[model samples]
Target: MKKPVAAVDPLRLLVAILLLLPLLALMGFGMLWLWQSGYLLYWLIAMVVCGVLGYGLQQLLVRQERQLLMNAATEPNPEWPPSADAVWQQVEALSATCNPEDWPLEDGRWIWDLGQKALETVAHCYHPEVDKPLYELTVPHTLLIIERASRELRRDIAEKIPFSNRLTVGDLFRIQRWKVKAEKAFNIYRAGSILINPVNALLSEAWRHLRERSFDQARNELHRWFLRAYVCKVGYYAIDLYSGRLALGDENYAESVTPESKADLEQTEQTAEATNEPLRILVLGRSNSGKSSLINALFRELKTVTDVLAGTTQALEPFVLSREGFTQALIFDSPGCDSPFFDSKQMLITAGSADLILWVSPANRPDRQAERQFLDALRSYQAARMDRRSAPLLVTVSFVDRLRPANEWHPPYDLTDTTNIKSANITAAVRAIAADLAVPAEQVIPVCLLEGKIYNVVDTLWSAILNHQDEALRIRLMRCLDAKKRAEDWVLLRRQMAGAGRFLRDLPEMLGKRSEH
Candidate 1:
């Protein structure tokens, strides 16, 4: 058993008093010396000068820190909704209406009120039909949003502002209390000093008012800085929730690709990339457009059978590609769009799941009506799903060797130098394909996927793939998030079933107990 001790120990109290007596006596003696020495005025002036300098230094540091936080606050996340610009403008306008005079330094309720208004601004942009969008969130999800916002604010403050980690709201209140008492003591001193030395007191009063004005301005700026950060960060997460971008259980999927492992895979091929779901790349084009040859070239070997006949690939074939400098992915060789028996609906479903697409169009083929129609349908399908990111498309204009200067087969053909007949023909073919497919010219890469003569396969084509990997990774994240959400739904359903089963078993006993009562 432990013995109980009093709140204040007598021995400790006595020791503290013993320690404080000498400090008090020494201060009294120093004051007596200052009064008699007649150099007290000079000593006081020095102290005032030092205090002003210290205050100026602190204000400068605070200004720089606030600037950094403001920069971060004003920048919106790339994944935010299309109305993010207008939402920010709305928030800024709302903030402009806030009166600094009404917000006291010690009171914090005004921030909560301002945050409520900010959340309404965000809800107006995302879900105007609902009168109370915030109330629609589940308790756990609301708490999660708060936790994420608070964590970001803490991280930014501790890292960007010096000494912020060491301070707290309680410390600020304590400092405010000290400032009040100091002002009271200075007022009394000024009253007495004015009668004794009129000129000195007048100068001191002017200096004190100047410092006070500067302090008030700094204090207000600090208050507004915190206000902007709080509102912006909270609204950022709120907009994410309302727009269906932020959800629970995403962290579990994100954890599969850690920083260290991703760095390893990107730096060296010896290390295989870790991923819960592989990025899906879909290959689409007309029949006999060198689709198989292009896939074989990407693999650096013959992985798919290529025939001179059309409609060789009748179905979608998926291949696992874990190449160097690329995320682990599944590349699907889709059936050609020109086939008479092709199902456009099934192809649309496959396109929806793809993260990156490689459209193989032969440079020799002039008939592109079928391809153009299919592309228009694909674009319409993607446009309907506004919440999902469209897969990046790269057009590979194959069979460039069969262009106008058919006799000239060159190893290196610079499209920029159009003076050469072969280069000019290839460039014209690329531009025509780009215009027909409604894709950017830069995305169209002319390649000869012919056997034993693969031009632009290793450098030009692979570089395009690598460049689109970041966007592909983003699409993959959304894909994984949807799968994880479905899995979570199943888990929650099981839990609810179990709870209902237990309640049914105990129903009779509870009813009997209630009757007895």
Candidate 2:
């Protein structure tokens, strides 16, 4: 256990007393010598200056203690984050008497690898039903719950700004500009007595800790108060919002809204006019490979129904995703490769029209021949005009939990961990898929959209996308959108040209005019 050190610790007091005694003795000796030399004025001045300096030192210590307390108050809360130790233990213990095909513990310790189990554990901590078991949970629904919870958590964190630190006039202006959102949340909370009730106990506990001089404890309590107040109370509306989005579905259609007032209608018109359209992301894959589930996961809402049955998607479905911080994007969940009604021409057109393409394949499926064929065809058709390499393809491999040695779901595995069979298999799987698709290994991401559990898709997928978001490519995509209603493969050349119809349009027309013999 560590000992607590306060600014006004007893040791400092003792040191001060010791130093003061020595200072007094030295002054007394100096005064006596001055008196003997008849220098009384000099002795008096020296005595007063030394006394003031000693007093200032004490004041400095007092000020430091106050600052320390303030800093502690602003610090983050203590959280006992949930883990998958028990889950992994069960898997490892069960596989203890296995052959080489087994789940292994780390360094012979009880520690397991950090993968799907660990990911779900962390997510479950913020879950509305915190103690829910992994097997019993519904993956997409639970993830949607977690997303709402986390978003509320962020909003609560934002509310502490004005109270968090001292602000200059300039700081206040910047905060006001940034705090439109914070103020809105604050207003909603203040507008009701009901919203503040849930956090009353937390506030009381925090106050008790503060008065008892337990600064750290107080900080922890206040953090709980904030999180609870926003996520639990103010966030009650989130349930309705999520449900509405789910029921309404991701189907975008033309609609007309007439405001009651002229000014309101004008404002609505202005807002719509100013709004930039979101980027279109088309998810491609084989049937039953979790395309709809991936889209719902991204939205954090069960907007689309998921099933193990193939041909679940019948048409090209488009959904708008407005995740905070990123640009609003349109994500389309398309019909799987194996759909009986699958039109190759339409699939080619849809894939080419997208601003981004997410090819979701199953990790367990050894033969990705179906998806590979579609991808190859899609590329070849586009290559008739522009460089096929211009398209940014991010392949997401799902069902990673089903990879061999069934129950093993630890993470932190890599192509480098030679000792671990799980790691070796995962790396091999990724490499094989990358080779089949003719894409780099980095472009292929393995995720365990673990059924009845949210796993590695969100962070790993988004991170890969952001990394590959080149400035030139983004500008080109934006230009394509502007020139045409949708960004298509044919328009890719327009992005590179100074003017539309300069290259292909002119050349194609000339060739047609000459005709064949």
Candidate 3:
């Protein structure tokens, strides 16, 4: 039989040695002095004192060493021997035998297996608590292993599954559920790890490969493990963008108009005749879609710019334009419409109050997502107002000047002219999009808002709004606007009442008691 190696307690041995050495040296000195000077009593006292000191020192050293050992072993990274490698290999072997399809209904066993592997690795590397199992390990190491295994598993799933097949109802439902679980695991294992680091860069490269249908290269990139763990998150955003569910880029103005702003504009309109009623036009489009520049062009004022990107307008701003014959129009500049945060309910409320809806789309890059959303909103609003006359919905194709050849600095004809050839081309493009949305082709109008001469564009829009003969719609819109204004005032009154109540309650406290004290 092989002899068992003795387990050496480093802390106990260190303490014993530290306490023994000084006493031994003192005893030798006392013996030499006592023999030379016949100081037997002094030697006796010194021996007793050294005995007590040694005992106390031994206890202190032992306690200190115990603490030091415990701390070093439990720290985030502990050095371990080759046994850790063996444990990891064992985990990898177990994982290789397990198929996700054979797991529980929740499919959580795979994650559990990964967690176990991480714990096993940590266990082989560090000393466990006296009462705990030898295979159990620290939380951080377990998290690391779980994250690594999850990446591998997800990559495998992605490779084995085809994208087209993944779109089936059952597959999509399963994938969505799996994503939720995976996201939870990621948060637990590596929260805040997705913020534009080297990991994200590698993930982006992996995503490109995946996008190109190069699953092999994508898998290779994903094999990096840490980067692949963020794949589901990236995939979610990708689907949103490609499916027209999430609009890309930013918006130049507030996409939704506040009830208060709508009311104020509406009240200003009812004071005049139908033609004289301020054209409370709501300008909308995707981010960087030239909404602000169009408004500036319509008013013949440099109030807003073309270069402004999406989400630039945080609030609805009302601009009053004074026309000839003392007529005025209230044009509300709103935020970009195609925002992920956009609320269609609020938009309906805003647009419903408008005399005309000027739906804008950029001429250069017509975003399909914005176009779809705009059409949906228009159709929904029109349906809701079926009993009343429909508000005139004019499609303004903006930024025609930017669609020219690189060699040409500017277009030959004025962009605002409906009869101009370039304008005609723009009109046709808008008409095609409108036709697809089931909108009337005659409703589409083209305008280059960046150019100074856009009077014709403004004139055309004014003409359409004036031709609309819906007294019922006009009355309904006025009533809605009035109700919204009243609600706002009521809220303000409640706040004022609360403030007054607080003041009354504090009055007695503020008034000093009689001098009975």
Task: Give lDDT tens digits, candidate 2, residues 1-517.
Answer: 9977674567755665565555445545655677789886775566457655655564565456545434433221111011222333333332233222232221222122222343344334335375653444445544554465456545544554434435554775677677786565444433332232333333434444444444443444443343223323212222222212121122221122212112232432443532444455778888988899888877767868888788989887666667765665557777889888688888897666555789888888878788888988987875663222334789887887778766887775675887888878888888988998887898898876644566666688877766655532453333332333232335544665746547766887778878963
TM-scores, one per candidate: 0.79, 0.40, 0.37
Largest TM-score belongs to which candidate? 1
TM-score: which is higher, 1 or 2? 1
Q: Which stretches of candidate 3 lie over 4 Å from their true place?
A: 1-279, 325-327, 385-387, 404-424, 451-455, 469-517
For residues 1-517, could you state the per-residue lDDT of candidate 3 as single tens digits? 9988666567755675565546545545655677679875675567557655655565565456444433322111011112333443443444344332443324435444444433443343343454444334334333443454455445644554347335665775788789887665444222232332333334434444444443333333323232222222222222222222222222312233435545665644543333333445677666677778777876677776456555777656677666664235567777777665456677777776666667777767744666676668767776665323345677777666555432333444554587655555655676666765566777766666656546346577556655552532353344343444455458767988999999999877666543333
**lDDT for 113 (candidate 1):** 74
lDDT of 3: 0.52
Candidate 2 clashing pairs, residues 3+ apart or interchain: 113-411, 114-411, 115-410, 115-411
> Which of the two candidates, 1 or 3, achieves a greater lDDT against the reference?
1
Identify the candidate with maximal lDDT. Answer: 1
